[model samples]
Target: MVTTSIPTTTKSWTVLGTDGFDSLKFSKDTPLPAVSDYEVLVKFHAASLNYRDLIIPKGQYPFAQKPGIVPGSDGAGEVVAVGNKVTLFKPGAKVVTLFNQGHLGGSLNPQTSATGLGGVIDGTLRQYGTFNENGLVDMPASLNWQEASTLSCAALTAWNALYGLNKLQPGQTVLTQGTGGVSIFAAQFAIAAGATVISTTSSAEKGELLKKLGVDHVINYNETPDWGAKAKELTPKGEGVDHIVEVGGPTTMEQSLNAIKIDGTITIIGFLGGVQGEKQPGFLDALVRMCTVRGVLVGNRVQFEEMNRAIEANKIKPVVDPKVFSLEDAKSAYQYMWDRKHFGKLTIKIE
Candidate 1:
C-alpha cells in the first residue's frame, strides 16, 4: 500500500570512489528505487554517521565496498510504501535501518556478515530507500527521528557488549571509556540497568558532562595515564570493574587490562586508539588477567529490537552531538566526527 504520493526521484548522496569524505556526491535526481514484494520503501527523515561512513570511501573496511554506494548504516524514517508481501511493516510504520540486514538471530556467520549496509550494498544516505522488510526494526515510539537514527549501530553494539554475553546485573560495575556513541550508550544502558558506571574522558568539562549522565565516577585519562588502576580501585573494595567496554584497540588495551576484574569481561568494539604500535596488544594479556576478552560486531535484529524496547522503557535519550548537519553538508559532519569534537552521535537531517 502506498500511503503517500511517491516521487520519481529522491535526493541523495553517493560514494563515487574511495577518496574519503570528498567522494560523497550529492544527487538531486537520484532515481527512487521500486519497492519489491517483501520490501518496504522508507522515506528517511534523519540519518547518523558512523566511523565506516568515513572509512568506506578510503576502502579500509574489512567488508566489500560498492562503488557509488549510498554511505550510511543508521537511518530513521517512515514506511511511505510497502509491497504486498511486506508483512512486518505497513505503510506509515516508523522504522530504523538495521546494520546487518541478513543476520536476524543466532550466530552471525560469513553469509550474514556480507549484508552490512553502506559498504557491501547501497545504504540509507538517500531520502528514500527500498529495504527488505527484515532490514529494519520498529523505531522506539518515544524518540524523535534524529534520536532514533542513532540506534542501528552504536546503540546495538553497546547493548550487545553489556547484555549479550554475561548479562549485566543490577549491582555490577561497568567501566566505559570516552564519550563516543558506543561509550555513551554503554554508560546509559549500564546506569539504566542499575549498575555503577565509571567513564573516562580527555577534559574536566567532558568528565563533568559524563558525571551528569549518572556515571558514578569520571576519570580524566590525560591527567591519569594509570586510569585503568584508578578505575579498578573505584570498584567494590579496590577490585576491578565487572565489564569494560574497550573501544580503544592496541593503544588503550594496557589500561583496559589494568582495569578488568579477575574473571571479568572486556568487550573490544573498536580501534579508536589507533592499531599501530611498536608491539600490538594481544590476547595473552587478557589470558594473564584471567578475564574473558570478546569482540563485538554491531548486533542482530533481535538485539536491535531488544535494545529499542530497553531505550523506551528507560526513557533513554540518545546523546546526539549539539551541532546538527544538513544532508548537503554531510562531508563536514564526517570531518567533525573524525576531529572527535562531538560528544556523542553525529547526525544529519535528511528530509
Candidate 2:
C-alpha cells in the first residue's frame, strides 16, 4: 500500500454539548490526526443517518462518547493515503469503513485502545477521517458514493442478521418491523434471498410501496394494532413467520413472539418502536418453544464484504429516500429523521 503525509489541519464538524444539541458545528481549522502504521486516511464524500445517530445526542447510547463528539457511523469515500502495514487497499480506491471499528473479521470485542471514528473517536462527518485499514472494504463496482455510504451500518446489520446468523432460505417466511434503515434493508434483503417477506409500516403509502417491491404481505400496524395475528394469518396454517427482523424492542416483542413460527429466529437490533418498556408476555415461553432471540450490533469487515458480494450478484438496490441537505443542513436532516418523516434512508452530502 502507498502512504501519504497527513495534513497538519483538516475541516470537520464537532458537537459541543448534549444540552439542546441541534446542529453539527463546523470547524474548518481542526487539526487532523497523524496516521498510524495500521491506519489510512479517507476523504469522505457521503454519509448516511441511522436512528442511533439521533439517540446519541439525547444521551441514550451509553457506549457513545460525550456530547462534543462527531455523530455519524455510515459513510463511503476515496482512500487518499495508507499506513505502512496496510495491504488490503491502496490509495485512490473507493472504499467504506465498517461501522464497528473494533469488530473486524466478525469478531466481537471492545477496542484494545481508543480508536473509534465519529462517536468514541473523530468520525467521518468531517471532510477527512483516519481509520485502521482492516476496517475498509472495497466499494462494489455497481454502487455510487451515496449508495455505498448506506451500507456500513444498516444494510450490513440486516445482511448479517438475516443471512449470517439466521441463514434465511428461499421460500421461508420473514417478518420486518417498521420502515427504518435496518428494517427497510431487511425487507429488501429477504425478498432478494427468495424468502417471502412480510413488512410492517405505520403509513399506508409506505405499505403500498413495500407491496410493489414484491413483499408478500404488509401489515399496517397503525391500522391493525394486533398485527401479529394478521402475520399468522398470512403464513401457512397460521403457523407464524419463520424469521423476524425485529427493531421494535419491548413495544412489539410480545407480538413478534406471537407472529413467529415454532423454532423461529428473532433478531433484535434496534429500539425504534420504543426504547425501554416492561418485558412482554410469553417472551420466555417463546424461547421455550425453541424460538431464538439474538441482539445484533452492526456487522464487521467480513460480513460487509459478503454483503457487497450479494448486492453485486443479485443487483439489489437500496431504498434510499435521501433528503438532500448541505453539510450546514445537518440539523434539519436529524430533525427530519427524529420526526420519522422520511420513508427510507436519510443522508447528507458533504460538499
What's the TM-score of every candidate structure? 0.97, 0.93
Which candidate gets the maximum TM-score versus the true structure?
A: 1
Model 1 residue-pair collision total: 0
Q: In candidate 1, which residue pairs clash?
A: none
Runs of candidate 2 exceeding 4 Å displacement: 1-6, 64-67, 111-116
Could you tell me the lDDT of residue 337 within candidate 1? 90
TM-score of 1: 0.97
Model 2 lowest lDDT segment of ten: 109-118
User: Candidate 2 has what TM-score?
Assistant: 0.93
Error of 2 at 166 (Å): 2.6
Local distance difference test, each candidate: 0.89, 0.80
Model 1, span 1-351: residue lDDT tens:
545777779888898877877778998898876777888889999999887678877767767566878889999999988888778988889999999889899778988888888877678888888899999999999999999999989999999999899999999999999999999999999999999999999999999889888999999989998999999899999889999999988888888889999989999998887777555667788788999999888899999989998999999999998899998888888898988889889999987
